[model samples]
Target: MTGRNSGATRRTPAENAQLALLLEVAGTPKPGNVDRRRDLEDLRFEHFLAGTVGAGKGLRRAEHGARVGIAFERAVAGMSRQSGGNTQFGCLLLLVPLVSAAARGDLTPDGLDRVVADTTVEDAVSFYRAFEHVDVAVRDPPAEMDDLDVRRGEAAAPTLRERGLTLSDVLALSTGDAAGGGMEEEARGETDGEPGAETEAGTRGIPDWNAVDWTTGFERPFAVAASIRDDTGPIGDRTARAFLEVLADRPDTLVATSHGPAVARDVSERAADVRGDLEAADALADALVEEGINPGTTADTVAAGLFVALERGLSV
Candidate 1:
């Protein structure tokens, strides 16, 4: 189940991660998100295919101690040029480190954490560069830090530099609690001395991006991976179920960003009701698309989960 090698006559871990991304997008009736049968005006199935393949290859070839931010920037830049649009930005953020960890012959929680802790300030710079290359929509930052707005893109680089924030620092700042407050409150012990401190106690003693559920430890991905691993059925069914479970468990941050907290909460509740009911889930998926409510962050997490599942040799 290790990610180091796929054995003779098998695809590499990078290839498996790519396949997982493609299959996740291809899974039909996946609620509000895009699938093989559904496509957004600016985002299409082909765009995802190109992005996944390009980013997966870039991640596969990345060297140890390489700045994940730089790797992410290169992957997204290539994808943007090829697809002429933004697709899989979040997927790349989650997968690049996993790819790097697998390359190092370890995909365990501890292994991945070590990789994340090693990211540098240059990595944070590269992250902001990637943001500039895309047209991602996110919620506004705190009122006090207008310069930190992601919408500002590379324009925020100087501020990031002045503050000496690393990639993990940026992620920690963006990480939000269920109540949508800053991470400061919930990140007490997990982070360093300051609430929501960038670093953790162990490992490299550097910033702890794993402080948030979405960033490190691959928490959500691991949960969904375990679900997919336990399933013994068609890959499509397993993927759909895993997506439902994730959607039901948490309100999608992307949804909250685009719409609002209310819409995100409603979608989560709907997912909970439809979970475990294939027919109901299908109907709900159609209704969500009609309503223009996409649980995109959930879909991104699902892609990462599929990657983990594949890396671990889950049958499918």
Candidate 2:
């Protein structure tokens, strides 16, 4: 039941989730993301490993109505204590609900939506608390809504409390303008603190939190899952291709925040350009890193997708 031989043995959903997170960071040639051979000055492979291990218990507790936000806070806190940095903030955000749903033994798309929809206001507060514990960079809130700024961290908690905004409500606001303004643009001018925008509650909406795969019934993650499900190669190849699929499909929000929308779109186009050739994709990865463009959100989606693949018993 140990080592590679353990693949044939059954693993709990939590174990599968943790392994998926590890596989994600370990996936090489990920293009601008930290991998086994690549490390940021402030983040490293060991840090992500630590974060995944640190978050294990919290992920196991996902069922029984454990608030995802609280689980996320505890997971990030543990990771910070171990690594002194925010190595897996986005991954944790995406994994918690998925892990929770998996724990319920019904991680179907509908089940995931239910788990997300069930999040409460306290969950939203705890999610904000997680931000205070890490130095994760996110886009600004709409210009008019100072209170909704994620950078405000715990300072915005009082208003969140006052407005009784549940985690879903907060996610809805963050999901940005339904007309395709993108999360980065929704808070651009603000509207005197009014709600940002809304979706049909069933249709696809732009994701505000890059790692929040559960927001839209795990749409992006499921898409990645679909791509890799048929692969029988090493887990790394599956992961790498899934990353490309996510990048090619959309501009990464983290890249957009760090660079700009134009740069993000350019990166997406480059990924699309290289999608058919592994060597070209590797070249693109090197170029992206050279230019300091990290498609981190896309990486998070890959991790979530890998989790789904594993949970569904897709051969790694």
Candidate 3:
């Protein structure tokens, strides 16, 4: 543990040395040097505590909710990066401290609430921007030129290489379901006697009654939901709401399908499954990248999928 700084007016010599040490450790190239990362995290944790106390005084003088919320959100993001390893598991560790601090009124709960409410399409982009170095991107699997019916499981999995994303390009994919519209309601006849206008008692019902298209309406959001689920597992209700709110500016609008209700239910369930798959992939990538694995073709596929999903929806 580093020495504590008790003096209000000046930094101790030990504190100055610790700050320098943190910077140097973060710049190292060794793979999974968690000890070095941990040092930097510890410093940030100290800053989080200090900021919580300091922000309370500032909040009293602030009036704009938006401004306050942005500051609060940034503070929380910083606190999250600190406190330990920056993996998803490490993030959970900070939740308890965050809740306790917020409960004491040291950190403004309203500020966080406002931030959560403000998850607009713009916010989604902003979220990516804030964490650019973390390698978060949209996921979209590509269409197999050789095999059109290929699923992700059959495709070779790839992990991140360098500091950039190359596979599962979410931006280029279409999100509509694979099925065409259901139902065959007749057009109102101009001629009353045109082709059996008056049907017998045993008339044929809708031919495609059971034909539900996977590539139809609600695809984009569902795909987005799927990717998020894959990457992070099924988030809580509040988290899901926050995510949807952030994507409010997405251009795709869904028309209710024949099985719209059923689709909605399935989409939610599928999102969770996707999330689990994604987290496992991320963890695998982290380990492989640490071990100097050559992603090669796998990297390209992941990047392609990510681009396709984000831009075109899940149709790819």
Alpha-carbon RMSD to native, per candidate:
8.1, 6.5, 22.3
Better of 1 and 3 by TM-score: 1
Which portions of model 2 show Cα errors greater than 4 Å?
Answer: 1-8, 63-65, 177-212
83 Cα displacement, candidate 3 (Å): 21
The Cα error of candidate 1 at residue 204, in Å, is 29
C-alpha-based local distance difference test score of model 1? 0.67
Report, for every candidate in turn, its global Cα lDDT versus the true structure. Answer: 0.67, 0.69, 0.24
Evaluated at residue 137, the lDDT of candidate 3 is 14
lDDT of 2 by residue, 1-316 (tens): 1111135666776788788889998887788887887776556788788878887777776644477888877777776666436667777777788878777766777878887888887887887777777666555444677776766767778888998987777777666533112332111111112222322231133354443455678787877877788865778877887788788888776666655566667788888987746678888877877776777778878888888887766654
Give the distance in Å from residue 194's predicted Cα in candidate 2 to where it truly belongs: 24
Worst 10 residues of 1 by lDDT: 184-193
RMSD of 3: 22.3
How well is each residue in 168-231 modelled by candidate 1, as lDDT tens digits?
7777666642111221111000111121121121112211122354355787788888898898
Best by TM-score: 2
lDDT of model 1 at position 31:
87
Model 2, residue pairs in steric clash: 142-187, 143-187, 143-190, 144-190
TM-score for each model: 0.84, 0.85, 0.20
